[model samples]
Target: MIAPTLHTERLTLRPLALSDFEPLAEFYASDRSQYVGGPKAADQAWRTLACEIGHWTLRGYGRFGVDETSTGKFVGMVGPWFPDAWPEPELGWDLMNGFEGRGFATEAGLATREYAYKTLGWKTAISLVADGNTGSAKVAERMGATWESKLNHHIFGDVNIYRHLNSEAV
Candidate 1:
């Protein structure tokens, strides 16, 4: 089955594609990727993209590659993610290099959260932010999510969990 595409005023949240590899690898290899388990080797980045694509195949929903509507430039990936080992379903976003300071993440994050809540019928959603990643925290805040709690994940470490408001708050 084909995944659905989401549209925000300035972005198009579409399924990941092969063309995203180079950018994804560049992002993963840079210091900017630290918060998202990056600074990885090229092969590792390939595996990461493969896993992201596989997530949709297995779970029926996963992150979408974010693109700028006007330029059609790939900016990042954002959407609902729920690996079996995760504590709960999560709304996550990773902006590519040089895409920070823009409202792209905020715009895409809101759309993904709404998709999870209204379309996927989720009652609640949370975004996990690496402790020092102030940028991600700001994106969460911009989308009306509140700081929920802190967790020391086996993988991510020193994480801050931000919970999105329920439907009534939307």
Candidate 2:
């Protein structure tokens, strides 16, 4: 099924498209790379986008484009990413450098969590934040996620686990 578009007061969360590769590549190519696993060549970025599309096809949902409501420009990405051998569902996000410090990540993340719990019927969600990513940790906290455990997130290296149980928090 085509995933429904999600709206926030200042942003829109929608399924990513192939057309997003360029802007996404540019977004990644610029700053904000550190927060998103570093930069990639344009070709590699396209391949990554293709893989993300495939992930959505196989898993039913994946990261959606976070766009500005008024401008419709891609600001970044946010959604669920299931890592290999991961013990639980993970909420992930990376906002463009320009969008940082504007509460976009927090707003988009909360919306994604709501969609996961209410629309997708997820009872719980987890966020694995890199130890140095204080901003993300703050967002997780704002989403009612508590620090659960520390784990070595294979893809992102060392991380702090944060948990949010829909029933208890919402």
Candidate 3:
């Protein structure tokens, strides 16, 4: 599947690549990843990135690797995803270490949400932010989402699902 490229004022979202592995591995190895099922070994991180790419091939839509347009630095992954056990398609985002505090996640997330609604023809979208992840919760809120419910998955534990109130707002 050909992944479409998306852009914001400061970032560009594109297909995942081999170059994304190192930083992704670093993120997964750190405690910051706990909310997103991280603290993984290098190999696990590799497989995880691979799975992200394959998600596009199989599902025709998946997370995009985002980079800072000005510096061309990788920031993180953000886009639409619906993994095996997920209840439904969702808009998700994960930022690299130094990228947090910059609102990059929210920017990319809003773009993905718009893509899911306008480009993918989705009527509604939700962001499955992990419980206790205040940072992500803030991003969701900034994107105009409101917590609507919670979900408990065998792997992800408890996560709060924030529903997008206006799909056309984007």
Q: What is the C-alpha lDDT of each candidate?
A: 0.91, 0.81, 0.90
The residue pairs in collision within model 3 are none
Q: Which candidate tops lDDT? A: 1
Candidate ranking under TM-score, highest first, comes to: 1, 3, 2
Residues 1-170, model 3: lDDT tens digits: 96799989999999999999999999999999999998899999999999999999899999999999999999999999988988888889989878998999988988888888888888788888898999999998998889999899789899999988666565
Instruction: List clashing residue pairs in candidate 2.
Output: none
- Poorly placed runs, candidate 1 (over 4 Å): none
- Go through the candidates in order and give the clash count of each: 0, 0, 0
Candidate 2 global CA lDDT score: 0.81
Please state the error at residue 5 of candidate 1 in Å.
1.2
Task: Give residue 140's error in model 1 in angstroms.
Answer: 0.6
Q: Give per-residue CA lDDT, model 2, range 126-167, as digits (tens).
A: 988888889899989988889998997567678899997664
TM-score of each: 0.97, 0.90, 0.96
Arrange candidates by lDDT, highest first: which order? 1, 3, 2
lDDT (Cα, 0-100) at 145 in candidate 1: 91
